[model samples]
Target: MRIEPAFLFDLDGTLVDSVYQHVLAWKTALDAESIELSVWRIHRKIGMSGGLFTNQLLRETEVEIDPERIERLRRAHAEAYQRYASGIRPLPGARKLLAWFTEAAIPWAIATGGRMETAAVNLAALDVELTKIPVITRDHVRYAKPDPDLFLAAAERLDAPIEGAVVIGDSI
Candidate 1:
């Protein structure tokens, strides 16, 4: 028997217009550590996990390594990102696309690197019904995007098989 297809959508920049917000948030986090780096540099590493993002940024900037600062930086980014929560809104066609899926009875879930607090804001802004489906956040998985763990977890939560599942997002 052929299994039904399902979709996994990324939260930031996919369903919601938060790419630039993420860039600014990361910059703010780095700045909180008194680490001065170009926003352009941080922008390139947008979708990485908090830990990986900090490590990669430090490596690329050739800055002194400080393992203790990763948590501080993450907390700073979380705080900085929360400021933009009220400004967040669904992207054009996001509602339509999700509605189409709903109407067609297709199962879809959110797979994101964003934390639950921020994800909750975006979902509320989009009016997405998490009760009906599942969301796989960075907290749910060890690795971030480009890693299949999030995808796998989302599928499992939605009871969708991996073979025919698809991920829809703004980034690669």
Candidate 2:
């Protein structure tokens, strides 16, 4: 007997062209807080956990930030991302690929470094119906990308084992 493989996808740049939108949103957030980090610098931390991103930002910029300010930045980034959400679209063949998997009776799920607060927008852009799809976001797990938690949760949701899962993502 052989177990079927599962495909785990990342939402942002992999499915939707929303990487730069997130980058810009973070820029807006940093700017709102009077933090002077360059966009390129922010892009380097795009697909990691937000807590880790903030910690890295502080470490690289040598800026002192409190928990309150960090929360404010997160709120600001979410708001800013909404402003850019309308411009986001599914990457070419992304919807097709998912549909193909569905047609083939393959188990698949979306796992993103973003929280539901933000992944919701990308999912909408991808035209993925959350009612029928298993999406694991940062809100669902203790950690995000580069940690395996999101993918692990997604596999669990699909009732698939992590051992032979294929992760499709643009970044770590």
Which candidate leads in lDDT? 2
Off by over 4 Å in 1: none
Backbone Cα, N, C clashes tallied per candidate:
0, 0
- For candidate 2, list the clashing residue pairs, or say none: none
The local distance difference test score of each candidate is: 0.84, 0.89
Q: In candidate 2, which residue ranges exceed 4 Å CA deviation?
A: none
Tell me model 1's lDDT, rounded to 2 decimals. Answer: 0.84
Q: Spell out the clash pairs found in candidate 1.
A: none
TM-score, one value per model: 0.93, 0.96
- For candidate 1, the TM-score is 0.93
For all predictions, the C-alpha RMSD in Å is 1.4, 1.0
Worst 10-residue lDDT window for candidate 1 reads: 63-72
